[model samples]
Target chain A: MSGLRRGSVCLGLCLVAALTANAQTDAPSRRSGYHDMGKPLQAMQDDDMANPGMLWVGEGANLWNQRFAAADKSCADCHGAVQSMSGVAARYPAFTAGSDQPVTLEQRINLCRTQNQRADRLADGSRELMALTAVVAHQSRNQPIAPPDDPRLRPFIAAGEALYRLRQGQLNLSCAQCHDDNAGRKLAGVTIPQAHPTGYPIYRLEWQSLGSLKRRLRNCLVGMRAEPYAPDAPEYVQLELFLMDRARGLKLETPGVRP
Target chain B: MGNAVHAEDGLRPYRIVGDAIPAPLTGEAGDPERGRAIVANRRVGMCLRCHSGPFPQERFQGTLAPPLTGAGSRWTEKQLRLRIVDAAQLNRDTIMPPYYRTDGLERVAKGFAGKPILSAEQIEDVVAFLATLKDQ
Candidate 1:
């Protein structure tokens, strides 16, 4: 286990170095959203009591163990304690069998509820989905994010990367302009941290709600003066895969707080 | 502010009003005061989100693009009007959102369909405010 971790760590460091290597020599080491936040927001994320996202995390804990009569099952029934699910969410957006489609952690959770538990699929941003996904994600709170490198993901990864760099919308901005080239810089007094998908199902004060990564992407599209995609669009999945791949070594901060 | 402009009530197409560089977007004169409010507002104009300028009192001013501090001195009112209406017409690589243009945009949220982010009057208003910032 330690050896595998070391290898992934090496890959993670290589990725980081490559990013900087591509930039001017004067640039400082990249920083996370956590590093760019003010003291108050940081403290808020640290204290579970003050963290509004914890409310959703708690809800997820209940849903895990709660039995659904319709499905004649509960997540805990098949998976046992939620604790065992640790480090599981960190390895998601996995290239699955059959079509080899990459499934996000949220999609995987929904798959289990519908297929194994015979329960209705949860809607995106539904409190139940947020709670369950958040709960499952919380288990891997500090685990390093590492999507598998199956050869199958290569095409999708390339497609996702293309989308990241592709300019779209009336504003003609791509994800790279703000996150890759100008990350850690101030934009409207807000630090545009590298577009890392570390903390998700995150609590955003702006939304005054916990939302998925897809929600943030939609918001970015809107900010770009482009129309936002519908919930869980294939384009979003492609983008999510790229974001997670870019964020390979960052520790999961699910239920993270953002201003 | 003449005749109350009364522009934001609905959607309409915009045409350049004069032959000059600093032409009015429409026959109506823009109220610089109203324009200032819209530019500072995050939801409405949100200029400061990606622009830094002479507004020292504002907080969280981003430094993503060229500041608007000397915009009036650099570009004529007509030029500013056109840029605000659709910056893509100027620089295809520009990240500035077109405040008034409504064509060729993909996947706009249902609420904003067929509607520009800022109304035509609001675009003029932003141009008005931007025109007040002389280089000095």
Candidate 2:
């Protein structure tokens, strides 16, 4: 069994090597991740019940009501009915009440757990963290993304735009070269999107798992053969803010499906 | 030959004399067969990411730039070498990444900050493969 597993791993690497040799990764195909997917993936996203990401949504719902032993609290106690939280996620990567640092929903959840419930911070990329973020973001489903307006966020936004345009990696490609400059063309069968941040806790076919927006950003950095920043890195939050700003007024597609 | 130079031979920045770069890219002759593989491979040249070509076997050609077909007829081997080295000289805003040049780029991975994306031999090989793409 171990030998078979090793063989499969080697095959995967060889396939990757073969595919990369034939790559045209520099196109500017700026459609949304949604528009890039095929029919089967689209259908999976349309029906919440059939959407595998909803499984995370389900887990989130359960986490929302469970009491935390640390502070004897649950999200339900303070936030009230989940439905009432609608439109909340739409405005995030926003300036929190106490801190000036803008935060994504994942960061907010960690803050709530540590500050309000006195619970330990959820591990980055942990299943529970994804679940809670999905639950919170799902409340804002179908709402237009409304990233908060505040001058305090200006510096971060500028930094993000700089990062977006700056080329990186051995390929010497930048996000702008593809996402901004060539948003609608194909890159060896994959469509590159304008790279909006409306979808968080997305169900990506490539991952075969639901993940946060930050996770995807890290993937892009890795794809460039560059070292990826950590999940909690300020760059991720700032990039999240900038993307949300660019996608301003576009409807939120939380628990979104992507290929 | 051209494709014979391995990346491990280590890359040195080429002088982009523009309309004057010496051809056969590296000092050696390039193997057209190997050169062709480098252009198609995602791990190396990734030329298809922006340009289309007569690579029928390789599906998903990009439409961002001009097709690679007829390239041999349009540009001399020397010209192709310079452009591939760094097209920024011809068109400052060209989305094409510098396949061989390594200086003056921003936010490069620490280890690759000074290294060209393609080794000198790889560039010669790709140029050789491209030179074969005559308008038929």
Top model number, TM-score: 2
How many residue pairs clash in all the candidates, one count each? 8, 27
Model 2 scores a C-alpha lDDT of 0.80
Interface RMSD of each: 2.5, 2.2
Chain A fold similarity by TM-score, each prediction: 0.87, 0.86
Q: What is the lDDT of residue A51 in candidate 2?
A: 91
TM-score quality measure for candidate 1:
0.78
For each candidate, report its DockQ versus the true two-chain complex.
0.41, 0.35
Report the lDDT tens digits of candidate 2 across residue range B1-136.
Answer: 1222213234653444435357455678778899899989876778887688888888877777788999889888888887887777677777777777666666666777777888778888888889889999
lDDT string for model 2 (A1-259, tens) is: 8999999999999999888765746443233577767888788888988898899989999999988997899999998877777998888888787886988788888999999999999999899999988988988877888877788998998998888887777666688888877777777667778898766889888999989888898888877767677655799887887888888877777789988
Backbone clashes in model 1: 8
lDDT scores of the candidates, listed in order:
0.80, 0.80
